[model samples]
Target: MRSHGGRVRAIITGEAHIHADKVAAITGCLVPFPNYPAHIPMQRVDYICVVDEIGDPAKIATGAAKPTTDQRKLLMAEYCTQVVANTPYFKDGLSYQTGVGGLTKPMGNLF
Candidate 1:
């Protein structure tokens, strides 16, 4: 993990609310109280994608490392669609994060 100023770099792609405070507590850095309530339960996944097979041109333009695949894109779209449909909290004004995967790219279109 990289640290700069008051920020601590932990997870590469996912919800910061999931890891930020825990990271701060583990590293003994001062935890910044979030303006929002910590009601979202912490979930642990077996794995999280840190890089994709198809590199995002947008990230590449900015020198970020990652790539995405067509298959991944298709799967992401299907899964993300299901997630949006199944979850009720995905309404207007709700904050959410999508990973930088090819499948996740079309999430906006789903909405």
Candidate 2:
């Protein structure tokens, strides 16, 4: 954002994110609040807005992370469980991530 000359950010303090923290820290990108003092040396932010609400993150994530209910997919999860459990690679301390997929989360549940 700094290399782009300036960037605009709409902030809702209730859902502050780590990426925003890094940007604010590195470039002091925040605009001063209505009654607060300026807190930047070189402002990379063209505009900063404080909004009341974005959405309920928990509700959004719950909807997005929902697993598959299809019978075929559920059977696939069962097959995956059987196959993986029989494999040498499925030993203790096996590490995996359940990222961005409906099937993946259900597969994890089976094991």
Candidate 3:
């Protein structure tokens, strides 16, 4: 992560080792967000990949898994917000970036 003229930028990436090439391709396909106005410019991205994964509900769902405690969730959100607030890159004109997911959505709300 870095900031240039108040625009915060990040390149989020992940890697996985899988036995099946098709799975890898599928997984890569799912990594990128659909293009939208809020998306950072494509020029900022150094690289990208598209992959696929099994989406069967039975295979993905965990029955009776305990939910995260409200307190823990609050803490995580606060911690994420605080990290951004404390960073030098944060300022009156901060441009935040984060993964599009449950925790990150809350963090963005806090920001």
Which candidate's lDDT is highest?
Answer: 2
Model 1 lDDT vs. the true structure? 0.50
1-111: candidate 3 lDDT, tens digit per residue: 234422322222223322323321223333346555534465555544543544655543343322233677768988979987898988875666766344665676678
Top-down lDDT ranking: 2, 3, 1
Candidate 1, poorest ten consecutive residues by summed lDDT: 22-31
> Would you estimate the TM-scores of all the predictions?
0.34, 0.42, 0.37
Write the residue-wise lDDT of candidate 1 on 65-92 in tens digits: 2334467666777787888777888676
lDDT (tens digit, per residue) of candidate 2 on 23-75: 33322243455524434433544444445565555665566566778889889
Which portions of model 2 miss their true places by more than 4 Å?
A: 1-64
Off by over 4 Å in 3: 1-69
Q: For model 1, what is the error of residue 24's alpha carbon versus the real structure, in angstroms, after optimal superposition?
A: 18
Every model's Cα RMSD, please?
13.4, 14.7, 12.0
Displacement of the residue 79 alpha carbon in candidate 1, Å? 3.0
> lDDT of each model, Cα atoms only?
0.50, 0.60, 0.54
